[model samples]
Target: MTKPRPPLSKELQLRVFRRDKWVCRWCNRPVIFAPVMRLIESKVRNAGRVEPLSYYHTHWTRDGAPLLDELGAVIDHIEAHSTGGSSEEPNLATACCRCNVRKSAASMHEWAKRPQRKPIKGKYGEPQHWDGLSALFVVLAKRDRSGLTASEKDWLRVLAGATADAR
Candidate 1:
């Protein structure tokens, strides 16, 4: 037979949820299906009565976004307690279904280092120009890689050519 776990105390859950402000700690935003419960006694202005706390694990999306439900939303810890992170309010956050899964087991600092934050060019964002010896090496390595696809090779060639012309 499966073991059943004891329910958490209402006061304790409320304390943790309130400290998190119903947002995911890592992303600092509400995820879609993060587990949230309605506090029958509490209400928010315009947002309605009740608040979200946590949700079922199944609701975590493949890309780490939270799924939304009629009841409310879910909150997640950026760094799970199992990984030596705290269970305090500062450790919790509200995330959409996706962000939570993506942030799994990662501290905010580690998650922020993910390459997902790539720079864009033009109006989308500013391009980060390569600088220093390491940057030059990346340019050269990209150019010299015979295994690179045509598009990648073309981009590397362009970068190398531009740098060479500048020098």
Candidate 2:
């Protein structure tokens, strides 16, 4: 029997997201840090003055969330873990929810058989500035640090260093 895999550490997941610039490996789409979306939802819902619409839940609904339904960030194994791939950073990739769900456990060759995401044929092509709204997440996280989970706190530190290096 295949043993159930343990949850990937938030630290490792963040590292992969950073490495991939939060773009989905399969679709080349910018992915959102879902937890940040949840925070935004809570803040918006609590503002009593702003209630005409609702932010969709991260893992639910066809209606797009604040960033879009397909944009939730996830870590994918480059080689299938079930097929004996290691869980190391090099073997992991950042993917959006839509592509990850579609690629579920398929071998690369099999996944290649799936319809490919079309490239932007525009003169400019894909925009290069996407950081998956990670900057926004960092800002909001600092504003609401009282509720941060240990993992989130670690993210703040990592991101702080990143932010520092960028300047």
Candidate 2: pairs in clash: none
> Mind giving the per-residue lDDT tens digits that candidate 1 earns over 1-167?
22333443334444454454444444443322121111111213224734443322334333222234321334456566546665556765544344545666666678788854222234654323312122343444443365444543443444345566422
Query: Model 1 misses residue 71 by how many Å?
Result: 12
CA lDDT of every candidate? 0.41, 0.74
Model 1: number of backbone collisions:
29
What's the TM for model 2? Answer: 0.78
Worst ten in a row by lDDT for model 2:
51-60
TM-score of each: 0.36, 0.78
Angstrom error at residue 139, model 1: 60
